[model samples]
Target: MRLYIDPGTGSMLFTILIGLVGAGIYSARMLIVKLRFILSGGKKVDMNANRIPFVVFADHKRYWNIFEPVLREFDKRGVDVVYMTASPDDPGLQNPYPHIRGEFIGEGNRAFAKLNFLKAGIVLSTTPGLDVYQWKRSKEVQCYVHILHAASEATLYRMFGIDYYDSILLSGEYQATDVRNLEKLRNLPAKDLVEVGIPYMDEMKVRFEKAGPAPKHETTVLLAPSWGPEAIFSKYGDQILKVLLETGYHIIVRPHPQSYTAEKDMIETIMKKYPESDRIEWNRDNDNFEVLRRSDILISDFSGVIFEFAMVYDKPVIYTAANIDTSVYDAWWLDTPLWTTGILPRIGHELNGLNLPMLHSIIDECLNDTRYAKGRDEARSEAWEHMGEGAVRTVDYLMKKYRELNPAERPDKEA
Candidate 1:
């Protein structure tokens, strides 16, 4: 008899094996720290004697837009901050701010190792899964603040992603309610949930205002989907493109950046199958404002870009009907339905096998429909409040928290 294992089980086993290896590495590192302390006759290691007062960590360069405004606020107020990133080519490294110092700290496990031993008064990050994966909380760090990069629900993160964080800066009050629900469900201590609005969207609004309107062109459809099994491209691939091309409308496909790396083979196959032409163009621009401006209607799955389009662009969206598996996410713990899914029907139309054949009609409806306008206004109010004041409010919260953690080193005035 031959032994057999399914792909799902095999993947799960591999993940467990990797996790065990990581645990061993972490144990060894801690043992070394302990041994050093014992050898020094009960004295602390003091790896970072000159502790940094404020620190910001970016796991990828893509999030620079989200942090740039806050860093600028810090600079304008004459406050010092350390910007650490895993990507060597991060734009934050090139920032001319006198008060902000940026440094590249390698990537993956190496970056996590450096962060696990950091010493800071308050460490702010957009990345989640602290103390759940490779990134462990450092004892020397007084506070860990996690800020949302999207206007979506905070429960959408992977299991226990933000559970260990000291505080979470939310974009809306609904998110705070969900966070509190999770805390009560898990018997966890409630952390600070501040509704500071969406900083990147505010920045995008400024850029859009300066760039003016997009040049007039043919009716355009932007297909921007999240990168995962539940995403549109991952499920239907070029089939969706074939359907859109039949409508004789210009189509733009801007895949999630992660698709280029995580699903490289899938993207390559799709691109090879349907090469770019005058009618069909593939977009991979770091900044999506140009493409977004030229688009009439958006076709997406569960990507946060939907909120950006509906809120910032003030346009309508056609979301694909894909069943998102929530078992691996914090959302599984909640009994209520996801807020994103609940609001989709109001703000846009749905695309699935039943309505896929009539995608052209749906696109036409979304483009010409005036009813969704109200939903867009309601969504904007719920997901993003105090639209243009995000950066200022974010800085205010950080400065106040820092002072609370270090009273002796408090500044004379707030930023």
Candidate 2:
């Protein structure tokens, strides 16, 4: 104390002391993790296994509809695939295929996700931005494949995230052209973008075929909007529901799942205000096929459901123009300069969300008018031209890429 050290010197000394302590703690924690890994035989099984692991990563249970059929194809072909999900409580892991291994990595736990990825030889997913930025496992897997869950264009995803994928499976020509344009614009390496149709829709079409057509009714309209700031549910949910309900047409309100996350209170209030009648109902079921099959016409706002409804059910849709202010998204909208082009007069009749009178008019027109019927057919054909039998092709592509990567350990023949 009598030495009278200067304030600057004392501050520097304190900073150094804190840094040393932090580094010491980090080193100790890492040492413990390494020891635990060894003790738990993680490396032993992962590194020395005779069969290479094929993994499908799912971020949510909603995607089970897409991955289940593809996983079934693998099972049928005698391929042993592992299903890894971020949700620990995901129901998909409960009754997994006999040959398929299911693992649930802790949700939002990057360390566990990386550990799971380290064990996978080939990884496939429809979930975008898997470990692209933080705690990346890009180098862990031999090949990472991106499958389009929606028919939207490539710009909907971050360019850097798409770049992280080794291959992409497109649903239609729009996605293919968009990916190529992105590749040229960003000067990034060309990714293997194959038009594999909609893999999820393949299964739905089979079910629909088996179920046959739904019975016609007096104007059944499903109001299925997407999630986000521009979502019709947030802006005109009350007005739209009120107007449609008053019209006495059977209405099914199937808001996007993410809508609950963004506006839970608002949705709850809507439900309480408008008690459900046989004529009106709020649906939260994970499966939308039944809703789409039953509904005669759909009224939505810039949602992928527009394409799914139009292409799958072969019906007309009334779309609300997206007056989206992307600025609120923290520069996220900058990635997709062409996002609006994906939806528009391309598939549905466009209308302003706030215009109640016009919205009602368009609903009537969509129900009765045959002029847009031809346009719907054209759009459906162009969007899902490869609808049927694409799941088989997707499995074929996965195996092909797997063989290319592991030439030495390739399967002698396809199962």
Candidate 3:
């Protein structure tokens, strides 16, 4: 019996078959992964014999800015790396890095894209967007390193899917120890997390020192507000404006790229309200480190920026979590206060009812304390202990591990 069908129907059937085949392949991969665990329960892959093509995902522009060096290192190691960026923020992309650039896929198609990278080698992500972060963390990868942006321990442990990670390179020993504790927190055996310190900071610090002393800007205040599902304007937007105008410090309110893109009108409204608030510098492009380098004092809550200000630049950060609900937030954010890493004052939890006067007074205290200069150096020591210094140590260790497992040029693993 000859089966007859319209051309469209045939095309649809073929598409369906392709989809089914992909699902089957993914399923088989899952089965093989389980079998491998059964085969080698507690053993690292033989990196010496294996060579992984690295695929690093950079979701936001700023993240890409920070991750460029690690990608270059991967290239230097002869890692066939795929460095991707979704946002057009990276001007350097005009003269793109020598390694492969994988954009357009975004996070929705991560599984398909991941498989592509997996077949080639290991896929690594230094800064993960929500969707990409989820796909990578949901399952075990042969070699995917999550070099989280922050040097905080609590942030990594409380972060979802730590169990599935192969190696979490620590920015410092403090963060590394915190990651190791995930064993008890999640009731799994103690696993090792690498302490590399912050590659990003090392890059920044070198650049700053070479650039020479930062031009003394007036009492500079950096105001970066969070955006999306947890956008900033909703909580303490207006209130921050009131205080910033009154205090007279140089203010730069850079919205999270997510928030700026998602809520254009809201961003405009907020900008309109505070036209002269400290010479607003909205970073709708790349080069955030420039803004940070210029600013003296920093203010924010929950965002990774606090770590940047306190650790990398040796600046004191005032966390105005005026919009957060502490009891709910502490658990949800999971990561403990940054104070554990550096001096961090508690946030207001609620936006409007915040004691703005008290907040200013605290700011005054920090400003008056000439000892803060010394304290910043202390924070750097703490960061070094937590994240590390050389910046290359952690990556070197992982590459060393990778070489041990797979000596071949193509070990069938990706970063």
Using lDDT as the measure, which candidate wins? 1
TM-score of each: 0.86, 0.80, 0.70
Candidate models: Cα lDDT each:
0.88, 0.71, 0.57
Order the candidate numbers by lDDT, best to worst: 1, 2, 3
Best candidate, TM-score: 1
The better candidate by lDDT, 1 or 2, is 1
lDDT of 3 by residue, 1-415 (tens): 9989997676456445545665677688667666766789856544223323455666555576557667666555555555655555544354355554545344434434444324434455654332223342322235666776664543533345455545666655566555555455666655457666677777777776677657866777777777654544666656776776577666777777767568878878877876753255555445677888887776665677776666667676666443344442213443554444244432111222356555566566665665666666665666555343444575476667656555754422353
Candidate 3 whole-model C-alpha lDDT, 0 to 1: 0.57
Reference-based TM-score, model 1: 0.86
Q: Give one clash count per candidate, in the order shown.
A: 0, 0, 39
Residue 333 alpha-carbon offset, candidate 1, angstroms: 1.3
Residue 261 accuracy (lDDT) in model 2: 73
Show pairs that collide, candidate 1. none
